[model samples]
Target: MGVADQINWVDAACWNGTAFDGGWNTRLATNQDVLEPATGQALWRVGVASAADMTAAIERAHAAQVAWAATPPRERAAVMLKAAALFEQHFDELALMIARETGGIIPKGHHEVRESVVLCQLAAAMPMQSQGQVLPSTPGRLSIARRVPHGVVGVISPFNFPLILSLRSVAPALALGNAVVLKPDVRTPASGGFILARVFQEAGLPAGVLQVLPGNAEAGEALVTDPRVPMIAFTGSPGVGRRIGELAGRHLKKVSLELGGANNLIILEDADLDAAASAAAFGAWFHQGQVCMASNRVLVHASVVEGLKARLVGKATHLPVGDGASGQVALGPMIDAKQLARFDALVQETVQQGATLEAGGTFEGLCYKPTVLSGVKPGMRSFDDEPFGPLVNLVTFDTDEEAVSLANNSQGGLSSAVISRDVGRAMAIGEQLNAGMVHINDQTVNDDCTNPFGGPGLGGNGSSVGGPADIDEYTRWKWITVKASVPQFPF
Candidate 1:
């Protein structure tokens, strides 16, 4: 069936050069149902490509990348520019599809699509940027360095913010003259995988340059281990990222990992309580706190903890929560039952261990209430581990040193924030915190295509994406040298 026959991309299961209903090899075909988290409805069924299918996709991508690399840089940029225009043209339809496929609220879907447009536009500029540098060499020689794409790139993207994360790597790789074989999380096949293939194909990207394979662990392992694919871009948990890193290392393939985060939002005593509370609430509950940059830990001054707690409770209690596609709800449902259970367990364990549940410790179906927990201290489950949910753990601190110490006491080092009236003090505190990206007056959940994204430690592998970072992440440096004549003495 055509994708437009029903919802935007209902039957878009897998695309290997062309959209197909079953796997490339029908004998090994397997299908998995894609379910909507808010309502337990099956949005579509995706063909779960096996390891052999993944290998075939990689081989095809490798073959296509050579000609793509030889193509003129302007032609590549033109393709990216067309993709960006197409994204804008179909903005509403794509937003609705994101909402239906991923349970994202309408506004969040719009935001994701908007970010995607920026990503595509940013990629369009990459092909024209200076890829190398000229260096001074010996008297009779010239030395130069240039950037070039690494044949075929393998991408493993996550479900949350599927469109942005997938396109973050996919668009740049293609613009840099590399073919890509993308494996989006099985739960978000349409928005993350096949939909991209359709958009790029419509944008005039050549056949076989981009392959979307939505499958399970077998396919992921095959993609990582394949000798033909030399680079892997992954975004998900630290566990999976570590595994991919290990396998990619064994095979000598370069890998870029944008992994998990247990982010912090620090509130100082001199800060405005109302503004701090608002930032905390938004950071903790935006997209139901499914983001890796969600403010799981909110560290406030001991003297003003009570005031901030009251404000946070009021905001959490009043925020609407339900199906995102139905109306203007502030929070949407958890992605699935497994994620719901994980969040619930952390809250339960924290409360049992003596953290007071200030408000919202209830859930109906997948819609978890925007929750707040006070008296939460170090060693608490919610404080130590990343509760990727709409639950905020409030910890009290006595001084700026304590606040910085607490914020740095985690396995994650992604995004963080500081809110205070004194701009200088906020900047000082933010600088001391060991995080990749820090905002002085904003919340933790902030992102843009112009800035470098990804952090140190478990947050990522010291690799970044966006703007100039793309040249480093998607391409490699090659040094070239020329001499006026062959040296006779060296031989």
Candidate 2:
């Protein structure tokens, strides 16, 4: 049965003063389903919470966080470890739910679930590494730098890769002793927020340390603007990220915004064409290219442009496209109809601008066939904006200088990749790119659970939210000094 024909709509889950209570329910779209994009199919059935309820939840979280933070880091680590184990135990179940809710292919869903487990494990080990430093100071005096939690953190998560991204933000916040009142994307709340809440509860988290409030932007806005919420960690579009920054700015709250990207992938003449082609295919198509770090633009050397395009097209064509639940499916439907429309509009715009459609430009229902376009220029929407779908734009450059120029043309500096047989040269180019993270001879989506992952500039606000360094994002540095003798007071 089609998604439109399946399920009843109801409040999937909500905060009830102390804990998340309710079950998942399907509801009709609040707007005309036809006018709404495929990605927006999941309607907002959960009753919207009043600002007072949100304020109360934040207050409760603050109260719980005082005691929760007082609990030793080791104890918090234990709970995180248990949650990781629980994540592993429920991997298949979580993967299935993720696939259904977000339209992630089965394999990709499984990969994200496994990665989520690893992220929790990494978060669990964070306390051991979150040590303070002693600074050299004047004789008979000591200076110490310590990390402190920000009391209550409001996490506003996006819909794409819902479970993984939400956990990526939440696990670190909880591990660092901050209470979290998460506002998950309205579309895929059950798969991530609801599931993780169960995991945390089972892992013995304090009653109010982790709360899930699933609703629309109003819900998230309420959380971020609330004075009790000291920090806001958000992952979504640059437009939304800007709004979040503005709100957080007005309140003088700490903010971490992981926004959109029109990432570039450069293929040098000396690069192993096969390796570059494979990486490009995976980077472009993974999770239907919904990832913030996905390579949206491809800049290949003119010397090997034909070869790279041939191999990439062949690989993209063989990818299995079907329902996310079928298990054999490699590419699933766009997250919802809204996303499909956006993808369609972008591709149409590209065609109108005179780009060549190399393969897979048509859509069947909500399924956008993996597409590749050649002869793309920097000024086109596909090159300047994020498509957030399984579409790849290929442009050719004659030299490394030209490639760097082309790659840096986009306003986004989230991530980039340089493929070349000359590792040193690729590394040099990678460093020169303005992206937050760059890969040599590989794709930008390759991330380590224990390594810092975030973009620079518009891609991110120079904050690292993953890896061992992630604890720093959840913490604030406080310096303390002790003197051997108190100085005489002067009136």
| Ten-residue region with minimum lDDT total, candidate 1 | 16-25
lDDT of 1 by residue, 1-491 (tens): 32234455333443322322223333224776789888888777767879988887887788888999998999999989898888888888788778777777999889988988888888988889888999998898999999999989999999989999999999999999999999989888778876677778778888788888887899999999999999999999888999999999999999999986679999989888988888999899988888989999999999999999999999988999998876679888888999999999999999999999999989999999999999998899999888889988999999899998899898766899999889999999988887889999889998878888889888988888877688898999899999988888965
- Candidate 1 residue spans exceeding 4 A from truth: 1-28
Error of 1 at 460 (Å): 1.5
Every candidate's lDDT: 0.86, 0.78
Instruction: Provide TM-scores for the models.
Output: 0.95, 0.90
**Could you give candidate 2's per-residue lDDT for residues 1-491 as a string of tens digits?**
53333323212233222226222222212321111123434432343445555676687788799998889889999999998998888777677667777777777778878998898888888776736799988888899999988889898888887777889988988888899988777667666577788788888998888877666776677898988888999989888988999999999999998886768899888888888888888888887888898888989999899999999889778887767667776787887767789888999899899999888988777778889999999788898889899988999999889988888887756789888778999988888898888887788787776777778777977777787567678988999999988978996
Per-residue lDDT for 177 in model 2?
86
Model 2 spans with C-alpha error above 4 angstroms: 1-48, 483-486
TM-score of 2: 0.90
